[model samples]
Target: MAGRSIEPFREIGGRLALVRKAYGLTQRQLAERVGRPASYIAKLELAERRLDVIDLEELARALDLDPGLLLSRLMGKDPI
Candidate 1:
């Protein structure tokens, strides 16, 4: 998988951006809630960074959402 791009996960970033906008939270605000820098949030939203399980949980909590539901949305699936 050398040089393989992360394009497949790009939609997750798009979904994250939409959710963040829907909640009326700026990237900096969300980063503050997650104890990360604004640039980190920007990177995630741009798919320039990959999200790990721990970060996903933290982001879900900060967004007042269930982690599973958030993951489902990120994966482009309807939440069950």
Candidate 2:
């Protein structure tokens, strides 16, 4: 089977990093809020890790975002 594309994850990671920064959060801070390790957040932001739905939901909650809205924004679809 072909490997999954990394481009989409890169985009999401970029958006996630931006959002986290906008909230004045460091990787460590976000990781603490999400109950993950700082390295997990770092790897995720670097696109070296992919987020499953549960992970996404936890992150969205930590970021004070709605999971659907966060997903939409990450996908470049703003539901404003």
Candidate that would win on TM-score: 2
Candidate 2: TM-score? 0.85
Instruction: Supply candidate 1's per-residue lDDT for 4.
Output: 77
Tell me the alpha-carbon RMSD of every candidate.
2.4, 2.2
The prediction achieving the highest lDDT against the true structure is 2
Off by over 4 Å in 2: 73-76
What is the overall TM-score of model 1 with all chains considered together?
A: 0.82
lDDT per residue (tens digit) for residues 1-80 in model 1: 46977764476677678789999999999999999899998998888888778888899999998776656754668653
lDDT of 2 by residue, 15-34 (tens): 78988998999999999998
Which residue pairs in candidate 2 collide? none
Clashes of each: 0, 0
Give each model a TM-score: 0.82, 0.85
